[model samples]
Target chain A: MQGTLSVSVWRGGEAGSFQSYEVPRRGNQTVLDVVTYVQRKLDGSLSYRFACRVGMCGSCAMMVNGRPRWTCRTRVSRVASSGKLTIAPLRNLPVIKDLTVDMTDFFDKWAKAGGVFKPTATRAEDFAAIRPTDSKRRHADAGIECIGCGICYAACDVVAWKPGYLGPAALNRAWTLVNDTRDGNGAARLRAVAGDDGCLACHSQQGCQEHCPKHLNPTAAIAGLKRAVAVAALKGRL
Target chain B: MSAEKLQTCLWLVQRISASVLAVAVAVHLITIIAAVQGGLTAAEIIARVGGNGAWAAFYGVFVVAAAVHAPIGVRTVLQEMTPLPNFFVNALSALFGIGLLIMGLDAVSILYRLGGG
Candidate 1:
């Protein structure tokens, strides 16, 4: 914590190399602080994305030492124990610049996976009282906190292997909707997540669950989708 | 069938067949171990299993489970690993499943016939 840390940051687009920059290490320093220092002081052209310095905004996530992590919450002392840090754009995504990735496909897949909620009742209808202790509500609550962070998406090998496959975050969103008692899109949602590119495509690797900064389990959500799909198929509703 | 329905059905088939294979494999392994431990010779084993209806039925179910389970697994691997067209992958998977079924049933038939049926 008293010495300069050797930080290797990625520069350029699809074709690029790691540019090493030495930064003064301090106690309680986050990886985001290191990147900010490099961009502000060392190099003004260094490109990255971050809104809140805290972990609320998922935009600060990047590949920290070959793992997708929210850099704002990731302490340098914990990650770079060897006094060396390798920071790069998130994997399984298109790199736009140094540390920023093109998130078009990531969010697009979320829509494709039926992550959008449909209303069963019109605005004139009375509010559907869903108790917090309800099993379905509880199930929905478990995965509803996801802030569209691509950490799970980047961590997924299935996403890396099959580009069309709906990644974990999207499926996790779908799961939350599936458990929503007021949601009107149950049948369509099941259909959307049924095929090879949907829930069935998940290899249950739990990479999404493993790296989720929100501590959500997309794997379990996907498994739930699989069961729902199977039930629908059996009931001739799919 | 629609692609979604077909994929879901295939997933169901794989899961069901895998369950069957799980039981079949356990039974097969246990039988092998028991036979070996009992000091049964090749001829003695054949004498007990060749003409036995129960053994034939068990093995017949085992072979079917394996045939169903393996081809689906093979199809998944081919689809994920190769850049093959979906049509070609489906065709190859179907052919593979048929081949496994034919070969498996044939082997079972031979064993059944060894009992002079």
Candidate 2:
């Protein structure tokens, strides 16, 4: 590894260009650490957003070498192509500033996809027993770990092609909720996700699956929705 | 039907028609290959299948499947590639489906009527 690393970061909002900076390379340094150095020491005006500095927050994901990745977990040595790095805001989103895209659309779509769980029973009732080994529980377990990192959403070609289309994160969350037997919103949730720009719009390209840090498959969830929607269509319930 | 319901209905139509087309295409190909290798002339082929109710019914099903299947696929492509709204896409899909239905059924009828004994 060289003593100095050359970094090129997107320096402004949607219309801006890349700005280069040189930082000292050190052992165990992450991409976030490099950005911190340039911002704290070299240029205070350079803007970015992060909170936990760990992988749990899912707020530090950005484009690294033209691929969306969680920069908090991404080590500099692993992704520094040609001894250089390029960092930018996630694609297919409205860039608010350097390395930060507005998340309103992402969260709004999640709501539109029925991402929230609704309780089927009132608080007066006893706690519902959910067997972990049950098929629905197993199905939900396979897709419930999404951190809303927006990496999968950014990686999705469907989102890029159609602005109105619900991206992968929202669809994945809908799939999990759809599997939740305790959730009382099955009919409504299914309706929400079966729209023209909902789960039915997914092209099954698996870009979301390939880029997901949680290893969850939104494509599979979408396939489930496709089957469910078809059944609903046949029954005249859709 | 509501727009959302129509979209879902089209999705079902596309999938079901594709399954039918799979069988139709395979049977059609195998029959063409067998008849050609057996030195069946156009007149001979027509004499065998022409005016046959069973042949007419089979081809009728093929025409229906293709008519429904082709339009939905094109609609999806057009929707993804262009900025056209859902209304325009639906309109295009309906037109394409109607056009395919008319042309395909016409061809099926002509083949069944040929060399009528």
Candidate 3:
């Protein structure tokens, strides 16, 4: 922590290359801390996005050493070796600039997966009174904590291989909504995530599960969606 | 075809082919070991398969499975490189798969007749 850490940051869009930076290290330094220091003290032109430095916002996800991770939670000591670090924008997304990627496409795919929940009731209607112990609620609870971080979206190889793929994060969101008993669009959501570039596109690679900071198993959710879609397809409901 | 139906059909075909291939490949391996252990000569192997419809059928299924599986795999690789529609790509690959089946069967048939099973 006394000597300066050698860092290489991706300085431009997809056509750009990594630029090296030497920054003084401090104790308990996180990767996000290093990036902040580089932008504030060393290079004011550096571009990055972060909010709620405590790791709740999920805005600071990046490819740290070729792995998608939340930099806010990653300690420099854990990732940095030989006093060197390489940080890049998340993979499979259009990079806007240094350490920042255009997330519009990621969210657009999410919308294509019907990520929004369509409720059956209005404010005039009484509460549907869903039981917490219900199996559907329990299933939804398992994957409902996603923060739209794009970590899983970036980690998915299927998304990279098939750019039109709805990806794990989007399917995870759709799965939660599918399990929402109050949602009237379960059938439609099932149909949306049914075919190629949807839940079926997932090869059960489990990369999303491996890199998710929240420990949510999008792989399992996608599997469930596959099963649901299969049933619906067989029954002509999809 | 509807996208959902097409996807399900592909999944079903792959799954069924995988199951069939598992059994066919095991049988083929065991048969090879037996043939070798029995000191089977070229003529002896031909005697077993020259007009044996059962052996031809077994090899026929094996060839078809190989054709289906290899092309499906190649299609996946091509999909990553080319943004072609799955329908056009998969149908083209299926034609290629059929060609492989025809070539494999023709070669097997010739081996049966030429004392080289």
Best by lDDT: 1
Model 3 / residue A198 / CA error / Å: 1.3
Q: What is the C-alpha RMSD of each candidate to the true structure, in Å?
A: 1.4, 2.2, 2.6
Error of 2 at A200 (Å): 0.9
Which run of 10 residues does model 3 chain A get worst, by summed lDDT? A194-203
Ranking by TM-score: 1, 2, 3
Using Cα atoms, each model's DockQ against the true complex is 0.84, 0.70, 0.55
lDDT of the structure predicted as candidate 1: 0.91
Give residue A221's error in model 2 in angstroms.
1.4
True contacts kept of each: 0.83, 0.76, 0.55
lDDT of 3 by residue, A180-200 (tens): 989988877887888777887
- By lDDT, the candidates rank as 1, 2, 3
i-RMSD per candidate, Å: 0.7, 1.2, 1.6
Sort every candidate by DockQ, greatest first: 1, 2, 3
Q: Which candidate, 2 or 3, would have the higher TM-score against the true structure?
A: 2
Off by over 4 Å in 1: B37-42
Task: Kindly report which residue pairs in candidate 3 clash with one another.
Answer: none
Local accuracy of candidate 2 as per-residue lDDT tens digits, B8-66: 98887888899999999998889888767557687777876788888888889999999
Worst 10 residues of 2 chain B by lDDT: B35-44
**What are the clashing pairs of model 1?**
none
